[model samples]
Target chain A: MKDKDGVSGVDSSSSGVNRRDFLKVGATAAAVAGASSVGMAESATAASFNPKKFAGTTVKILLVDGERDQEGIKDKISYIQKTHGIKVEVTALALGAQLEKIQSVLHAPTSEYDIIDNLGFTVSGVVGGGLFTKLNDYIANKELTASTYNYPADFPAGQLDYTSRYDVAKNKFGGKDVYLIPGMHSGSVIMFYRKDLLAAAGIPVPKNWDDYIDAARKLNTGGVSGTTMIAANDVSLILVDWYARFASMGGKLMSGTPGAKNYKPNLNGATAVRAVQHMIDCAEVSPKGVGSFGFTESVDAFSRGDVALMLCWSTIAGSAFNPATSKVASKIGAVQIPGDANTSGRPIRGGWGLGIPKNLPQKRKDAAWMVMQYITSAEFDKYQFDKYQTDPNRRGTYVDAALNKKYPYLKVAGQAMENAKMLDVALIPECFELVGEAAREFNLAIIGSQTAKQACANAQASWEKILKRAGHLA
Target chain B: MLYSLGISFFEFDRVAGKWNFLGLGNYKEILSDKVFWSSILVTGVMVGVALIVEVVAGVSLAIFFGQKLKGSKFVRAILITPMILNPVVVGLMWRALLNPQWGLINWFIGLFGIDNPPIWLADPKWTLWTLIFVDIWQWTPFIFVVVFARYQALPMDVFESARVDGASPLKIIRYITLPLVSSAVVFAAIFRGIDSFRTFDLVYGLTFGGPGRSTTTLSFYSFENGFVYYRYGFASALSYIMVIMATIGFSVLLKWIPVRRNH
Candidate 1:
């Protein structure tokens, strides 16, 4: 079977099914798709369509701990079991442990998990590794999904390209093949500001990096920092903070496409340096230890009304508008991160997806997919958002009138999500290496240890070395 | 150890889900890698400075507690409080205390009319030393507890004779007390040295080996490569190199630092 990246010659030993058998099942499944009774199972509401079809059977799922994705499942496990008659067993692990678990289990002859969640950044590594079953046939089977399920169209178009589809033949993303389903939560970096502070200081919302810096300086008084952001030794600095600024300034992330011999990071360009310089300028108006702050610290500063502005992940900073958790709950405003004349601010695409492992039995895969369909459906999307305030993945929920009224930022955040740009370098498995090297050097620049030019040059050198070692650079 | 050693010769291809033979390529690259070398230097400095400070301070506290003064038991209990806390918790506790904006440490310093204190965790120049200071605070009590027990077991006859001979307290400590506790100090040093040499969680909780990789220890560096980058072969090689360096360093330390054992 072909992997997500289109790589052939997968070791069938683990799946206990040779290529011939795999193709036979796929061909059979494809031919008999319309005749299957999976989606056609009787139900009261298509959204709550649960059947006892897999009665007394168990489907094991793996979820990332500490995320709303896991919380949603734990909250409704009993309902799922009672409705579907499929016992749901969940194994939730922290991000690192979860990834390791995926790797080890998928490689074993008989995998333990029937369903698993993949972080967006690791999609290329996990899903691309041919660990998950090709979900296109399952999705195309009308009997399994409801008429209102609207699998692909329901999710943001960009997320489907980034986190769900993989061109197995071309070994790249944006492929026609669907191997994963984007759900649980999805978000991007957006600017969050104190409306009260900005209005009091007579400063309009920043439209570009220059204006952002100017507003920060003007608002830096009265014991409040003008702005704050993640600049510490963190990958988010690269994904959420630096990349947003650099991309907004029209700096491309990669010089060449994945699998190209000349693939390298576009780190030392003029626009990249200018973006770094902008971060340094803004650092002057940030809190005293802003250089060391991550999302939590920066968001806490904004929540406590100590910072006037911030560029944060909508999922993290969403709490700032909750009365119970924030001091500025009624006083803050949200917008797309400011962009330059050449480009609109396109924050990094961020989210997670759920998929079925390829090694699972046919019955388990069906049961797991049924559970997945229920959880990611539009009905459940609205349900989760209302109950847990999860970062909504379904487009309908993002533009929901009630949600928009209660959370004023919903409309703006929805726009940001629809237009979010993913890093080109993330299409390859060497994503963390590229981002981590640049994050370290840019952090040095933000902390005043090096000039922007020097930091960019250093990052470029490191990227060159890493790409060469990864065989992406010649 | 053997499995890691085996993987050191093969490069893991994440997309292909297979391993490629690299022989000594990982080791060769790591030898010239500046970041690996810097991590080694940071680890060395952290272990050396923390070991010395903890040993010295532990002995001083041990001597003070050995005086058997009023409320000595309560003070002794307080002295070993930090030793029992997890290293990660200690790192997090100190991270808050060192926060330049609202931390108690800077606030206490501000009471003396100072403003604009240094950003301890953010500044590359001071981050390594700050980590060392935090490690010392947490582990120093381990040495004190070990040596204090030895001090309590020491016979009183020697101290009585020293005082009768008109030996001052300082002289008595320098010649008699120190010699008796040297063995305990050496034992504590070896244990603390090994523990500090492989420090990962503390650094992860504190600065995450950063600002600009200023505080990246060897273990954390290996973790970044293996888990974050998925360069299994290179990470395995790097870890083995650390093992070799630590082995040789400890061997020499055990030889050079003599501990006298009194009958």
Candidate 2:
């Protein structure tokens, strides 16, 4: 697929990352990933780093399927075997089954996987419970690390805090201690719209929730619906769509302290009501049966030119910018989720992280680290992003000139990730239950079965019940 | 089985990796849980409605094809197609077909001059019935095949004597045919009843137990708690409650059917 970028999307010859740009990317990565001035400066030079240190060792990886993760790894397996001299085996399963598989693998007498990629939300339960090996010692060892391997700098700081680093003693997300590295992909919510349609309609790019609704109403044409969303009674309803609007509208999600069993939900607040009501308003302009639309349907409709706007994860919706998958491929534009006049859009951070199970033998764990380093490297981040559009983890990959030229959404997505907020409820093991209950109530409201206020009240009640039952609320 | 049953009495805190004994607390919470009771009603409605329709439709088809009419042999082979496909695949296929905007079903209905059609999988009023319809579409064939086999094996003299006695086709079916085939109907109903009681894959693939627990069967709820929520003890207790209900319900049904007199 040749575009104005003058490079083939699949051309292995043209790796978009130059060494000079990559070095610069490493230095400023932390700032781009959203944090105070940070660096991964250790005194090790290139002479100490060896790629083939673990020759002939086999390392197995487990990842959740359908995220375009396994395909890209399979493409590079031969290259890895030749360059790194290690055999890499990857197994990807559907999300629920993979979570169950991780449970069994972790508890097994001998761990089944050398490196396990976990869902970001489940990190609290797994890593917080001390089921993963901390990687601080391994990262500090020059012989085991690549000289240029930018530990937490190259990844988003919010993602690092959520998935990579954990304070086991305090049972909190962020600390200096490292346990995992963001791999496969990391993403945040961004809005996709039809540039041509908005321009033709003279509708300015929506900068706030009110503008968004007005634009959606104006764009609802003879053949096209105005907008779509993940309004289904699925977890994405809460995480992807609703949370973006809620946070951007200045709604605080939880209050009190998690450790004291006094966590309180803010679902019944004014901002929460407005956020849900905004979804209820958008449903009027959405496609028929939009209440049942999951991530697939909403994105598919936007790609097909049947819907004009969508708020979706950058990872799943990247296919919409590809010419092969999308009808409006050339006319699409991506931007951070819109905020009202007073605040900024802060979509919930969504992605996975790779870590070694605590039960694995040290030898296997060491071998797994070598493979893990390569998969999370800036070079491979560009390689996979260029080839498969698996959302790049490194800010350098998102900012690569050739990639930006090929896919215009990269710059906006890069900006979006730097500001993405973590779902506070995800720090608890009952997150799925909490998110699920809210999703059901919001879905009913979106479908006109209940009022937005009633939905919020019900959701608040349900979340409180669940939190109290789980001993996270008094 | 016993491992899950034992786990039912103990809550497994997944993060802490410990099983704390709850004894009857799990069962007590489950009984009081509104979602659990709603799921019970959903499952009850699904099994009751789906079984009756499947039995009636299955027996009618069995009686229709039992005559050995011409081309019935060819049609019979095609009749069981829905039952052959996996329930998940069937659910997905129906979901696509029921898609309100561009689905083939709605489009076909549009040809009749109706601009708007019911959102089959999304609407609370329609989702459960739509599920029951899909179940009947798939499992009615099971009842047909089972009853058809029984119909074929029945002695022809009894049917022939009834015909000679001037009984009409409908009368013969009601008086003689239904009585002899009552055994197969009971067995097929029980078999289909159990499968319908434990409906999970269909709900997972189709509606995912909502617009708000509208189609969440007991089995689907058990799966959501065990797998999605990681509430192992809660899910296990729910499953046991379903078991107790199924045992008592089927036992009463068995006595009510009077299958012994047919022999």
Candidate 3:
């Protein structure tokens, strides 16, 4: 699988971070796993760093499955034990089951996982509810975070706001209180387009919603459809598709604060209706029966070169650019989500957060922080991104010159993170309910069973009823 | 059951980690919930249609196989293969086959000069029927196996006497064979009905209860509220309601059928 650059997608050979070389000695050295052989040479330099401080202690972690979370960490567990002197055990679960597991453990009188990965969608609910221990004290301590680790500054500010800090008292986002740290991955949606098709048709890249629709219509020729999207009855439609369009159009999702008595969704507004209508129009140029597509179908369509354009998660669909698994790898180009005239396209922030449960013993919390710092270090961030193409949360890794040459999409995705916005409804615990209800209604609209107005209106009513039942509305 | 019964009396707030007593509030909420009622309607249509098709197809196959024709044993073995496959695998296989763009079902139909076949899994009008068809395809063999065993065990002397008495084939089957197979048929119907009523895995793998709740069943509804929404109390009440409904339905069925022998 050769790319346009004539480099094999599987080879990190020319770059100093050859996976085979790293795997050869990964069992003996910890810092080597984090820092590539050609980079800073941290394994020898950080020799004074004592990993055996808590040698006998074992820290249990719960990680979400998929996209290099468990794989990245599991590959380095032996190295971590050697360096940190703490044994690591990881239990990974599917997205839905992970949420249930977190809820069950946090509600129990005892703790099962010393450190847990918080699914980004549930961060506001779990963190706002005070399920995790505050990590500010640990971050401030040199021994826990290490001397060279830049602490919070290493991660993008937007990611920190979305995954780390939560205002427990106000039950809001963007407070100074840090409860979690960005782990294994952080990502947002970006657009992937067929450069060859757009070039052949003499069409420019779409910059706004109106331009996007026009381009799609013109591209819907020959055997290929213009574009594909995830509008199936899945939560991703709410996250990646609707929210990307709505927020970019400057639509405020909710009018009131979470947990406020007057809190209500702004679902039936003009912008909301227009966004749904735009999605319906996009449906016209998509492959037949795309109304039922989830991530699998939409990504498969783009990867198979059956579609000309796609807007999808960077972690999941970013691989379509790799020649190893995609037919259009050399022909595709990626960019930040398209913006409208009024606002920039802000793809809903998506990722996992690492945190220690509040009920854990202090010693365990300290040991857990050690492991967290090691896995999330800037060096490890670059390592995993180069090895497995896991989305990186650190600013330094995305901007690394060597990585950009291999994966050009990283720069745009990193820019996307700087301006990304968290899903507003996700701040509340009933997030899935709001998103789920709206997803179903809008799905009906996409399938031509209802008008955009009718779908938005139905969604508004369902939201109001749910809010009232939860005592968020009077 | 007792634990769910208790939870039904309380509202468990998963986010705040608190539980409050609601007494019969959960029940009252479910009674007026539009989604709950819609789910019941969907479940009724799906179960009713699937049960009728499965029973009829199963019995027809059973009687055909009971003739003991050549290679009947080999054909019977092949017939039950779908029943043995995991429901998840079946759903996935059909999901591929029913794909509107590239699926074999539409492709085969297209070869017959039919263009633009209905999207089997996406269109709201067709999704429910498609699911029912898949259910029948997968579970009909279970009924066939049960009724076929009973068909083979029946006394041969009765059929001999009926034939000697100059009864026509249709008359013999109506007066003697039908009566003998009545108990087995009733048992199979009740068994298949209960299983169909509780369908979840297939729906999860198939449409995920949508094109817009058109394929949602009571079990799927209960699952979404409990696991998806984390509304433990409300979901518990929904489950208990389904339990009561199933019990009442079976009680009526038993009363309607005369399982006792007249002799």
Q: Pick by DockQ: which candidate is best?
A: 2
Listed in order, each prediction's TM-score against the native is 0.90, 0.93, 0.91
What CAPRI grade goes to candidate 3? medium
**Which pairs clash in model 1?**
A5-A171, A6-A168, A39-A143, A39-A144
Global CA lDDT computed for model 3? 0.82
**lDDT at A203 for candidate 1?**
86
TM-score of chain B of each: 0.96, 0.97, 0.97
* DockQ by candidate, in order: 0.71, 0.74, 0.64
Q: How well does candidate 2 reproduce the true complex, by DockQ?
A: 0.74
lDDT of 1 by residue, A1-474 (tens): 333422122224332233344344334433332222234334535554446656788888888875556677777789777777778888888676787788778888878988888888888887788888888887777566666566675566778987789876666777788888887788887888888888888888887888899999999999999899898878888888888899888888788754667987778999899988988998999988888998888888999999998998887788788888799899998877887774666678898888888888888888888888777766666667666666777766776667778888765666667678777787778887788889899999999999999999999999898888888899
> How does model 2 score by TM-score?
0.93
Q: Docking category for candidate 1?
A: medium
Please state the error at residue B259 of candidate 1 in Å.
2.5
True contacts kept of each: 0.85, 0.81, 0.73
Could you give the candidate ranking by DockQ, starting with the highest?
A: 2, 1, 3
The 10-residue segment of model 2 chain A with minimum total lDDT is A35-44
The TM-score, computed over Cα atoms with residue i paired to residue i, of candidate 1 is 0.90
Docking quality (DockQ) of candidate 3: 0.64
Select the stronger candidate by lDDT from 1 and 3: 3
